[model samples]
Target chain A: MASPPTPLRAPEHQVAGHQAAEGRLGPLVDGAGLFFKPLQGDGRGDDEVSFYTLLSSLPSSSLPSSSFFPSFHGTRLLPASDGSGPHPHLALEDLVAEFSNPAIVDIKIGSRTWYPQASEDYIRKCFEKDQRTTSASLGFRISGIQIRDGSGAWKPDRGEIRRFSPRDVRIALRRFVSSDPRSDPDRALAAAVYGGADGVLAKLGELKRWFEEQTLFHFNSVSVLVVYERDAGATLGKGKVKVKLVDFAHVVEGKGVIDHNFLGGLCSLIRFISDVLTGLDENCI
Target chain B: MASPPTPLRAPEHQVAGHQAAEGRLGPLVDGAGLFFKPLQGDGRGDDEVSFYTLLSSLPSSSLPSSSFFPSFHGTRLLPASDGSGPHPHLALEDLVAEFSNPAIVDIKIGSRTWYPQASEDYIRKCFEKDQRTTSASLGFRISGIQIRDGSGAWKPDRGEIRRFSPRDVRIALRRFVSSDPRSDPDRALAAAVYGGADGVLAKLGELKRWFEEQTLFHFNSVSVLVVYERDAGATLGKGKVKVKLVDFAHVVEGKGVIDHNFLGGLCSLIRFISDVLTGLDENCI
Candidate 1:
């Protein structure tokens, strides 16, 4: 009953996921989401590096020190074990192989977030012969939202990304800020997007007015805030981004409130805080 | 208190909105969605035609149609003088030029959806120039989703189709079905994904299986039902699939829904039905 007509643009649902390897990873349902925090590939030594968790063929095994998932050079660590009971295990090599990306190099510097699929075994083997996830799971702070094709309506071969224009983001910002229009446009630009409740036609006018002005986004330690004015459509939708340390799933287990790595293990948001504080980078993890 | 440990994915947020465009199309947005339905382009009209609406100049005409978005071609009829609001708008030769989309085409086919943006000027022009929507609001079905950036972090410059290998699909499919060890593998396979209530991981596996098996669908004027098993993955987390339709916003608009021109929106399971229907396709349409 609380479903007040959603004004946000919908997520693309045209994806076809593959089956999970038996003993290695578990069964994958139609939609399995894994979150990752994009890590900066700084040249920190193993022990000096910060990350999330580490798995072991045995729990006592030491972690590699460096980050397994650098924004550039990523690591694929698996759960300590799989196929036991209430809590199964995830394999490591599978993680890296599944997340291998080929087209990352050709992306724009900082226009958006790039959340691709885990690579194929063949692709993974090409990069690292072992293709095994290491022991460990970490977490990160994401935009904290995931829209999946849980229903599988859209597909890549037969589907397409229609358009991402300024209006799309504009309307979104307006609808997001409807309940409480920001008094100071600059203070709550990005964060403003998270809250709103629009009425009928009358509210539409308020949203439209936002196009007449300019908007801004501030990403800091807390939540990111985006602020905008009325009728400034010229500069509302454009930016750059990356996946960081908190997004690592193997390192940290729980997500939002779900920690069932058994089916589709969640990528922890807390992982980023943990990694930043613990210095458990993957290379030496 | 009702948030399940692994609560289901509930998309109630509209990330990118024309917060302003709503006013432009305000009269059309009743409790239902757009008061018009886009007719599946028969390809009888122009090879390429784009439509635009603006928030400022919307005729503010009360919509008689309930939940129907209109579609327009080349022409204008004019608005009723008594409309709530009115505007003397600007003129653009081609909507796409204002949109700066020189090569865009409009036609709905296959398992795809679209979300194109229109400037207030262009939309206003459409409202004033073309009488089609002015007379009656029309609508378009989602043909595909557009992620501001799903390709390795939203780099519009790096235009690439994230592709999944056949092996990857298998991995995703197998992983999809491993959700329920209790139900019949085949029927649970059908129900777990296509039916019943399961976790996101299992649901993901269901979607993966649908793609690999090339399931087909059918609508009995009720809910959607999918049936397939050929290429279904035996387990989860294996194969090689590139992330397809990563942006979930489009799915909100495109997935699992069919529409009557200028009528009901986001009907249940259009994509799910398509998957089943495709299985019955001669060439795997």
Candidate 2:
């Protein structure tokens, strides 16, 4: 009754940052809203699967509202986009599907992506990477960014974003919101997308509040995915800008302790966005 | 087929603070979710009516979401509870109608309640009151508060709250969340209600973000009404704790200028609540 899934084209439509290096398996889409991410055969895939399953079973009251994460629609077996035969794929709501043209940024939060239970090699690898990026000092790093230009084409920055310094990260964020060169020079959309009721900052504040008290999981290497419509005349409305948690392969049980690592990084990100808002205001003055 | 409207008898259920002094007209309910607030025949009532009416006509995209204010249900002619015959009332959504034994606080935000267009006598009166209360220094003052005590009885603190100093305001807020003595010693409800998504702080943050950029109406003498269930076992859930903007009698057109007066008071209130949250965490430690 339905057509087989097709590979998600366009770099802007795919998960940006770390996935670029993985080069193993890419995600698929139904051309509809469903996003099918090929599950890794390693334990990482099982870990993510279990996390989503556990989240599904827990009372929603005990967790952040569903909007904070991609809506889980269970796992599905699908033909791999790479023609690697049928493989188990995670069925998730496409974060950017609703937008005509979207500007997206993938930020991996936390100063450390290694947990106490992680292998020594993994810890060392993550530590080196953290030190090389702005994450070590600023508690967050821009993993990837993609924004549409005046001509209605996507301009994605991945290599430079991954290596961005703190100042560069700030500039990258500004660029993410200020991309459509044809828009108003004042960049009102920045405030609307980053500071509105359902904007990225508000959503992050909600997640930070939950992280401050939640004793369920210690999320390592998780990404805060921000997406917003980049159409020339777009203004913030309901669901105009989306902020969601993705990539939970490194999650561990909280063991009744707060996730200070994640919380600190989140606070840093909030501060940066707040600064951007203030800067925008000062510039207008 | 419908029952006649009845006066809201319980003091805890009524709008606290300024209403206690007004004593002119009070709100009524149909035992349903609709709140019928008696409109003053004076210009103040017409001002509020105009604001609500204008708000109703605006596309929701152009204003803060309706949840920020109680859902306006248009005007209605109702028989006053005091047997004042039929009077025009602003029928609004009853914010606390669903809560069981709710703890409510009415905080009048802004340092200067008097507007440029107000009579000199009114300005002097408001200035004197602001100076006497914590509002002059702290940018906000507790207008009234009602919380359930250990015995499950309402404890209305009006006089003391109205005249609360900054220190006293902080204590009053702490007590508002920690009212149920039989609950967990750590006061998880404090973080849950004040820090959770859709909680008072989160909602205030949303309002602040909107105020920072919006050049619509300058809200003066308005109250940020906070309400939550004080039932011993109550936990945060959807629509559990409500934070709303109320009493727009002094609102004025912004004329393309930001409402710095209201914004300053909002930030101050946010700081105080953030302090309460931090102090709560220290006490638990």
lDDT of each: 0.21, 0.72
Docking class of 2: incorrect
lDDT per residue, candidate 2, A140-165, as tens digits? 78876677656764344566566787
- Where does model 2 exceed 4 Å of error? A1-12, A15-24, A152-156, A179-186, A280-285, B1-285
Clash tally, candidates in order: 193, 0
Per-chain TM-score of candidate 1, chain B: 0.19
The TM-score between candidate 2 and the true structure equals 0.49
Candidate with best TM-score: 2
A67: Cα error in model 1, Å: 8.6
Two-chain DockQ for each candidate model: 0.01, 0.01
RMSD of 2: 18.0
Give the candidate number with the greatest DockQ: 2
